[model samples]
Target: MAASPSLANDNKSNVQRTKTSLSHLPYEVKQCIVYWVDRFQKEPHRFGSDSLLDQIAGGINHPGKTESRNNHPLLAPPSAQLTNLLNMHRFFHTTSTTNNDNKPSIRPQCNSILALCLVDRMFYDICRPLIWQTLDLEQFHLSKLRSLRTGGLTRNAEYVRKMSWRISVHELEALWPDLREELGANDEARKGQDWDESSRSTEILAILEMCTKVTSLDLDLRPTELDKQTGEFTIDETETTSKFFYPISRLTQLTSIALTTPLLANNSFTEQFLVRLIRDMSELQSFKCYGTDSVTPDLEGFSWPLPCGSPLGLHLSELTSLKELYLQQSDCFDFTWSKIEWAGNLEKLTFDGCTRNPLRTLHAFCQKFSTSLRYLKLDYLEYEKDVYTTLLEPTRDGPLSEIKSGQYRLDLPELTTLSITTELPIDLLLNFRDCKNIKSIELAMNPSISAEQIRELPCFWPKLEKLKITINTKSDLARCQITALKMTYWGKGIELEIEDEDEQYNSARFGHAYEDDGYDSYDSYHDDDSD
Candidate 1:
């Protein structure tokens, strides 16, 4: 054999020569090929026609990724729009969408875009942006990011649509090694001082400038310091923290936002910061706010920016383009039903770990958007006294008392999925007697809920095709009986599961109740309360 160096050179020369003719292919044609390949490799079985060539090309890039015939009939049909949304959150994992179906199409797998990159130089250039579409600020390599932004490694900063970054006061010193001077006058002063505008806020402002195209942002800025000894998250009122509203307002393309910070509900400035930031995003579609544990804001106690007006409500109402809203791990005493104007257009609504609403608000909300609302998830909910009974009341020999109260028919014809976990009342299920379109229903509770109540769900939701429930019971006989009923439902084309879950943490993690487990674990903090 010739010298090893010459052998390697020859091999590289041969590989390069093979792709010399690829340039002859039209740039648009090359892009078109890569686009469909990217979709097939990552997308679900969307209801659209695909050419034979498309499938073959996609298979070349991703060998195993293919559609299956037996996807769960209950789950939503593979939506191209929803698949794109799912890809955006894969980087943040915390708020990722999940499919309970066993079929391969519903379950999105992480197919490496690297394989496409290896095909050729042009292929790499075309497919590179998608790989960087979602950036996790913490896990991302800081050195490569600058190169990707400005340097000639192929700047693809515009591709970053969804990004999440976490900032905790406990780790402030570590994050800003050079901010010691601003932190304090001396070593003792530095250690004693809390995080302020001069420290962490400046750094965040700089970071946001780099990713201007970010549409979905999960920003968790916990100004509160957690005492290691006592294991409590506390915020010092005296210290002044910088407002992100000004910097965040610059991200005009922002549509979906998950704002997880303790300051919003606890501090007035932070709440205003959120309000101003939201007011600017006229195109915002989905909004989720994570507040401090148990510090649910009461709608009754809120001081409106306008006299006798719900400022937050009014501010939210201005978001005419808004569609989805999720409020979790916070109370909504001030977030009344009447305040929301998106009721006509809102498609999805979720309320988790929030205080119960008055009967009138709940009923009016359900009725207002009954036609438009496709998804409703209520977990770790608290209901006011007699609220359930009032909603569950059947149409009697009374006049139309409330809107659409002809015979107390609370119809949600458009509702496809319903989740009721934790303090969610079984009577709420009964209220859905007119919800003929509901295909999926999730009900999980402690052993306190009776077997008869769970059994009666099928009767109310005649159209339900999927059911997930968890009940805690010590009796083996009880478990068997429940499992038997669940199987009976399953046999009737309703994909069903009856989890005899004993773990309190699992229940708490899934948004049942937050038990004081000394320190807050990741599950307890974020509370992935999806059903």
Candidate 2:
């Protein structure tokens, strides 16, 4: 064969071609394409769309990277507005003050994935899943129901039920007519049912009945309206759920339920309600509710709450299947200790601000679980992140896990992790340091804690493989320094070894030590003349 073109010549030819075409494209259009691909992972529609890149016919020279601009600093657009607020912490903390910093900005990849769907059928197929996955109702809520519910079960609720959850009670009302129509309601029967005092509202019962069957449900019910006559409820807006939502006797498939706005209270309001709710909701894996005062009757001799030892009251103690419970600001009611029972199967629990409001039966609190409890968070209620200090100035570290007499001496055998997001007022190390199963722990503190408290943290957390500690110190660089001390597990049988394989002695290394094979000289530490 004749002499083939040189490799360099071939590369040069390709470069020349790239330079010519790239220069001809509008600069803005190219940048637009980058942004579109960056956020959504695909280009815009090739047929009809305004792009800066498409405008530039030609340029004098080859296209070159423009000066850096700190745009799209956040990489992922968080799902919740609350999460966006939280992301500001990382953004503000990580931002550099240096004038010449040239770090590239990042946009969430979800955007790029969305753009691809609009490009072409092939690209749409590839990007549709990513784009839609982000739209899943796992993190969203539907609060508007009046109008949408008007469309009836054949329309909105039927359609949305397949794609999303988190429905409001109001939506249920608007869908009442459709539901009534679907359930074969006659005008004469409707009036009689409405007049029935002992009966539950058909619409409210319907939404609960229909949505409870959904596999992925975390229903949050906020009381919108309370009946003035028979005490039935009618939310402001809601969707039409399935027709015959038999009172709580049949809803056994619910996965999660959040009862907000005290629609059910006064151990008497719905004796049948509780009995039927707990007994029938067998599939309810997680539960939360903000119950109100046990009862507030409208008329005299109404003496609500049909005796505490009654059969209806015993249903709560029977909830053995419930796994996770969140008591979020749920202390408006003076529920007694006997109201709740220990769910041996519980795995995770959160008490996010259950204000201590004279619990008439203050007996449900406990420090131990029948099985291993994996996660527990109770800090959002109070300002103190140091759950230890909150337990009355922890003077020592470890086992005081229970503090009934305003003191803790509790046992947590299965605790594999612990976190105290506040300064250790006493020895940060507590008997909990003996939590042999623990592998992760996070300790943070507010500015209110004293300096001495922060200094005692090193010894508090022991045997931890993963740890996060926040120390409040003087910001004055000349007066402050931080040391990351790494220690190995204490010797089990023999003496403790001072030498560890992972240890690197900063003090031993020479400031200017050099190696023969052109190794760089050490220069991390300053050689003080005084020393």
Candidate 3:
């Protein structure tokens, strides 16, 4: 270690400095250097793959990097600005030179791609934690693990090495498997002297404990095979029961949680898991639950989790601390459902599916917590008649299944933005006609909606500070109605009332070019989209 006096000495000579190295730098300086080298300077890390190296060097490091650019001491090894830190020495060369033989890793974590796999062990140790800052647990990735030779060990290890904690847990089961083989294979630890559920459980338990570090968790619960004999669905007990539970239970710091899948079609854990998950995440700030199937009422005899007798509705009532709630594709009348009863603090909401039942129930639900909503999103939405009310209408003393109002009452006094995909009627605009606090409104029309019908929506979004409309015809906005403070077209990005002269050099268009999702349309020109 260099002496403290030597580190601070401004007049130190080469002899004095020769004794110092990366460790001798101040703590802040060391952090900056490591942040740059690991995140930016390492060319492979920037592109999230090592292919960039071969591409730049024709399967090697660029000749000029080692001979000229890298050797420059003054500005050669540059990192990102304070707010942005990236060491771009490697990345710059990859782009400056041309070599396209190598492939880049997608969603490469800083630890595995840039640190461990691409760099030497020395680099791996320093940058491990940063790579795990954010994780994405896609369901398919884990499903593949269930079929691996090492009994999900190889898949788990390889994935863990790169992602660290961002991974899916419930995918550790095959779509179809014989009950005997599945149980027998999972019982190998029983063959040993210490063979017991405890040992087998411990193996997967460790995987979950490691996943506690994940800050962003995405869970997709899709359909699995049903037991042909009993007409009951089956999941890998070890994966969902052990591997999935532990991490979810302990990951209390998660800020974003997305619960999605089409499994509710054939499976019954949709509501059960959602409740258990919400209960476990007491500090959760963001929650999104999207279902791709109709929700069926829970049967009275067989509980979802037979061993642990708990229902979804009871668990949902426990989500008192939640701030953001999003629900989609839920059948309105499903006795056991995932609906937001009290979203007093919800800041953002995106409904991917539209249901008439929920719409009827929404008036009362919205009134219950109308004071705290900020943003609302509706996609693929279409109004439906209140089946709940229609049934109750026949009997006067029947259950209060329908909402008091025919249309959903949106009393969001603090709402700032509203995004909905629907055909707006001219008279329907009266609902938000006088919303003074609303600053932004995004509405998507179906391709089939006539231009005449499109114009029928009351043009009273004038209070909007930002208005975005997607039109199939160029003439839709020819004399666009909403006179907002800031009017932005869907073809372009959410343009601000202000201008960005330097927008030409911004990172607006800097991701996979082929992913032309509407979100990235205007992003094609993002300045950061270079090598």
lDDT of each: 0.52, 0.35, 0.41
TM-score of each: 0.61, 0.41, 0.47
Candidate structures ordered by TM-score, highest first: 1, 3, 2
Model 1 lDDT at residue 164: 64
Cα-lDDT of candidate 2 = 0.35
Question: Could you give the candidate ranking by lDDT, starting with the highest?
Answer: 1, 3, 2
Tens-digit per-residue lDDT, 83-164, candidate 2: 3222322212122322222453232343444443454555544333333221123122222222223333322232221122
What shift in Å separates residue 471 of candidate 2 from its native position after superposition? 13
Q: Which candidate leads the pack in TM-score?
A: 1
Model 1, 401-453: lDDT tens digits are 33234333567888887777654345545667788888888777554456666
38-59, model 3: which lDDT tens digit per residue? 4343334235444333333332
